[model samples]
Target: MLFVTIDRKSSVSLTQQIYDQIRKSILNRDLEEGERLASSRGLSAAIGVSRNVVLEAYERLIAEGYLEVRSKSGTFVAKGSFLPAKGKTSEYEKVMPNVADRKPIIDFRGSHPAMDQFPRKKWGQLTRDICYEAPDHIFGYAEPGGIRELRVTLAKYLQRVRSVHCHPEQIMITTGATQALRLITEMLIKARTGISVEDPVTDEMRNIFFSAGAGIIPVPVDENGIIPECLPKEEGTGFVFVIPSHQFPMGGILSIQRRVQLIQYARELNNYIVEDDYDSEFTYEGAPVPSIQGLDPERVIYVGTFSKILSPALRMGFVVLPTHLIETFRRLKWFHDRHTSSIDQLVLSRFIEEGYLDRHIRKMRRIYRKRREVLETAVRASFKNAKIIGRAAGMHLVVDIPDIDFDDALAGEIEKQGVRIYPVEHFAMNKGRHTHQVVMGYGSLTPEQILQGVTQLKKFLSTRG
Candidate 1:
């Protein structure tokens, strides 16, 4: 009989145990291909397990391609056809120990909004109201340019908040800022043009631009954000993407002077600036900073998303375009998606006009500001040497690990200890610059979780020596 064992007392079921043993035997080459497994009755009697257990095991083995079941005949191991040949590799099934299977004790992963914090009841009522008050036009395919009311409301909202200058007609709705960026890149990144991107920028943008076949010029960023002085003075460059309000990963706000300088550079170079006003709604101190788009609406393509302010699954965002480029953008948008969902646009429009969105944001602002303070206090009490970056605004903060590189090995070690953090190196176009940093998202985390997670991190880092 082929070697196998079963434990009746163990939590693992008999079928699962049998399946695992048989699979291992085949993988280890002990039971060569074409070997026949014993009849279920005989195996059951020999192993002192139930006949059904043996039969179920055989069924699973057959289902998984290890054993083949014949009509009213005994089960037999299949040929070595599916197995990898000697000295060959399969990247598809490259088996690593399942790290994700482990439950995290402290979760600090970024960009996730607190679903519990959102006013679900209020939103539901608003959605219901929109449906109840819908006119005949609401039931049909909306204007390819999005709902008129939403565009008008958003234009006024952005103008008041970000100081962006644009009419409702100039704004185009999108699925999200990511989609907006994708559409923009496809529409402009070709024709042998190079886009200047900030080094240690968002990883998704790097991939998006690269896939569009655009050459990238990595501009270095400092504590004050992207150094405009370091940008290449070239004519071939057509796009400059920036996170001006609160820089991603590193939380440095672009000063008014730098903002003006950036717009002046874009104007002088005759290139367009893709201002991703991502996560500017959660400022802790002082008045909100005016968006760079406010400087020169004609030169800046301002992108905003509801993902941060509201929820990500909503997939709603808009771009305020220049008057001259509105036609080009409209044409591009017409061919690409045409417009966002009519229902979502109308409902969101009502949410804005009814002042629910502002009310919600105001509440969250105070809540997040306190959470930020609590996080700071915990980190300070725990990891005294660690430096916090981008603390004034946004959902995440970068904790500088200092001197040591937070490589994959270190990340794995921390993960093993039941805490998760994103290494800053993952976001860098050029490595080694952000090696000493890790992003900690506290938007969804409570004060207790943040304290406990940071405390765990401090302990883990302290144990490194």
Candidate 2:
């Protein structure tokens, strides 16, 4: 029965102060569950406060489920009243380092594009041209599917390069793949669909699917990507979302046979397949892998985005729905936000038409390849136990840092020395196999920065010894 005195001159009211003090004591275990509270008059006299203040404070505690009162038995700590301190502070605190304690560091956050290489001059010119030539109708609410020109361009671009089959009318442009996913889940998914996702996949997508109330089932990925055999033998599976071309955070491309198996499995379950061609444009290996959407357009929904090739700030991504779902997606897009920005769509159409997007991706592929090489070489030189994966394509790679927990505390120490790496464990939902690995992004980092950041990372690890 700890009582705190409150000053009337203070900004906070006396009742609030009393309520907070009592709550803290309860949380700290000084006041245990089912303990009787002091009478309001007694508490007021003991703490030099009015009975009204004590009553108000106790009422608040009662309303908050921390206390209970009976008609004549008086107030007592509620049943199951034990309170626990918010525990996530320890998790976040383990990673908190004084920014001034470290030098300027390079970052390796995944999904980041190299903004330093974007053609700003050309983009500004095109934006100006679109605005100058814009008609009044262009500014009004257009089709929620997307601007006809951008959709047509995407349709052609995907078919020619990636082998995705779809017409312009079937394409639905979204803010990004995240929104594209949200809109699809909202429209197509009702109650729990057995949503199958790759193990060691992007945490963002997992969260989105889970938040939509889809029961997520983790399917393992081997050297050839998400193993089709691992999918649950369930009847109600609505879809399987895959990043078959350079799987996110890990660079495994699905073999042609596995891709066929996946399509066949989807057909058997009567489930749709979502092919996220996320960063397929920059694959440096043998001719870029053909999109799985080409195998069975009726069962595959092809999602493509300009975020990796251009910049995320552009917020341009699209989904090429099969014929059956096209109208449903259009209605979903219409109700979601009317449509994506008309101005940005117009500018992107010109960017693609004039060959800047293609040229930019070509140049970036070379630069990123060299950067990836630099990172791999440095990791081998600095750390004896680190095993690198997914270097054949994409802007990032996964490094298995053996003999270290690679948890939040270790991540903080590396960050303190001015090097950044993402914990692969944070991305796991059902806790996949890669607990000791961290995903490293090389897209935005320069060759020099990669070398320096790796050196700092080694120094940080040596201290752990």
Candidate 3:
């Protein structure tokens, strides 16, 4: 005999309720295989449901193989109906590792924009306006290369601001620079070909290449960016990856002389150059440097993103490929994700066309410059032996503190003090060389937070002495 209950007040139909109960019981093995079940007429009376409701429930269970009818006899639990049970979900969760709640800290880990300062009102209005004004086709699947309006606007914007020479047809929009790098790596990395990258490159970029099964040839970087002469002269090199405008962690701008040498080297080797012009617009000392792509657009793949200038949440970035690689990239992009969000692309196009992007960058440049100044001042005042490395550009600066090895142990101790700082060695492909340096980011921090973070760092370091 099976004991079943029915709820008269439930929105679920009586027939469905009965069907679900029996199915669940069989699956749970509470109603064992080959066990005889009561007749529909008897169950209706026992559960206070109509006989027809019970009949329908049993019929569904029979059709689903949970119950079977034996000619003259009543329904019985089907053979092979028993499923081995996994342990309770709660039991499994009890053994899962627990991640502690993140505490508020003065985070100096850079590459983040001031998200609070995002022009939400203007962006919201643009999104609404674009949705209403755009054609119905705007919501459909976009071209793999991206919508035409955005590519055109970005082409003009890049040409004017960064001196990148490219036609709109060559631009490919991606989820972010990260994706752009991934796709490019996938398309370029052949068997026995390796990527030549800066030594102390961002760990994220290094990992992207590593994930693609491409070998990494680390060219040592200094205060003047990647040493052109140090780059591998072999022919198996696929391309040279660089952050010339503002080298990450080290913060060096590649000189025009080295830029030309890099282009000549690529030309000689028949390989290409991948220029990542991230956060180059926030220069505090002088005008932004012209992109190396402009020097030899045919040999350089220029990648840029709005994450550093706008917000990472946008996940908007583009890559300018050589004319020869455009078709292949489009095919790769089409199969990758079928293209980025079409409506977002359209809204971003209008934002750039109407000069909102330029205005926003200009506003952010001033804010980041002031924050960088605060960080520089605080570090100088707090650490008497600290020497700032790199140019006075980008959101983060590297400070060389002699005799201090900012290893994992020291970094963890600093974090315990309610502050977070990134060690330069953390980003190094060749370790131990940058142990005395730390990268300090102030883009997302206020003046007070920067000062307090520096003070905390000073106190923590003094205790170790």
Candidate 4:
């Protein structure tokens, strides 16, 4: 007889507990490969959980290749099954992105948008009204791609604002950029593809590709954005992922000439270009550049998120697929959590349809532009050698420091002065090129706060002499 225990008091589900223990026994070699396990009914009777619960656990283990079902026979562990051997030493835990270091007086850490300027009142009303107006289907399992209403509205919106050309069928709403990238990575991996990414990208983005088992070729980016000439000449390179509209951290808009070259490069390589139009809404100096996707829609994958233009707390993002990849992308998206929040999608659809998004962007644009100006002015006043990088667009800019090592030690010193700043090297993959720079995000701070933060930074640098 099999002896199994259940903890009714535990927050962990009974199914999960059973799965974990059974998996542990296999990994510990306590349960031999091909050993027959108790039937779901027998296990339920022994442990006193519902038969269905035991069945669910067994199904999960079977799906994961831990167990197998034989016709007219009891369940048995899969033959030749082995879990990775446990390391003698415990593995290091991942560090949280923003480790709370006693709330600083001024925050210059990048990746924040102007939250105070969000039209909460209008948004709440839209949510309520849309819920009232949306059909019962909004609460049910959404259409695999998304609710048709949102997709249609976004199609029109992107075309009008970003010069993107896409049909409603080619657009898919995702939980966020993370999900979009995950699905895209899976698709590329299946195609036996290698991806070319901007060298100084966030570790979070890099990990996505690494997890998908895709080869990562880091291409160099100058002021003109990702240099087309530097892209991989090697075969089997499937795509180049770029934020050409507004390059992140070191915010350079890819030049028109470079955009043409990139499109031509993709055509020649027979590859795709993933355009992450992340922060194009807040460009202060010139009109926003049209998306590179417009130049060659057939070879480009355009992804956008409301997380930046709206509140980050809201996980709403969309991916515009090429016609060739739509079927595969849709099929994979359906299996990846079924659909995003239906209600949120419906509400966002109505919000865009009623022109609320345009109104909000216009309002926030003026506000963030001022913050950028305030930040740049302070930088000019404090450092004569401050080589301001990527100020033409985006909420944050990079200030390159020379003659001094601006590493963790200097960042710690700045943190001690009640200011938070992110070093550019923090985002670099191969490193060294961006070690002399730190990124300052102004979109989230007020004019007064920006001035004060810069003053503190300047004072700290003065003390270094």
Q: What digit string (tens of lDDT, one per residue) describes model 4 on residues 50-140?
A: 9999999889989988889998988988876766676664544334434564565688867688888888898899888877887886778
Which residue runs of candidate 4 sit more than 4 Å off their true CA positions? Answer: 1-105
| Residue 461 Cα positional deviation in candidate 1, in Å, after optimal superposition | 1.9
lDDT of 1 by residue, 324-436 (tens): 87777777777878678888898899899889999998988887877778888887777667788874787788888576689778888888878888888888877877888
Model 2 / residue 278 / CA error / Å:
0.8
The order by descending lDDT is 3, 2, 4, 1
Q: Write the per-residue lDDT of candidate 2 for residues 1-465, one digit (tens) a residue.
A: 675867778999888999998988887878988888899998999889889999999999999999999789888888776767675768667798767766776798876888998889999999999999989899999888899999898888888899988888889999888889888777657754668888878888988888877878888786689888888877777789899999976789999999999988988878888889989888777778999999999998888888888899888999989898888888888887899999999999989888888898889989988988998999988888889887378899888877877776777778777777888877765564777889899899989889988887887788767
| Candidate 2, position 228, lDDT | 86
Off by over 4 Å in 1: 1-100
Estimate the lDDT of model 4: 0.85
Residue pairs in collision within model 1? 251-390
Count of residue pairs whose backbone atoms collide, per candidate: 1, 0, 0, 0
How well does model 3 score by local distance difference test?
Answer: 0.91
Off by over 4 Å in 2: 1-103
TM-score of the candidate numbered 1?
0.78
Q: Clashing residue pairs in candidate 2, if any? A: none
Clashing pairs in 4: none
What is the overall TM-score of model 3 with all chains considered together? 0.83
What lDDT score belongs to each candidate, Candidate 1 first?
A: 0.83, 0.85, 0.91, 0.85
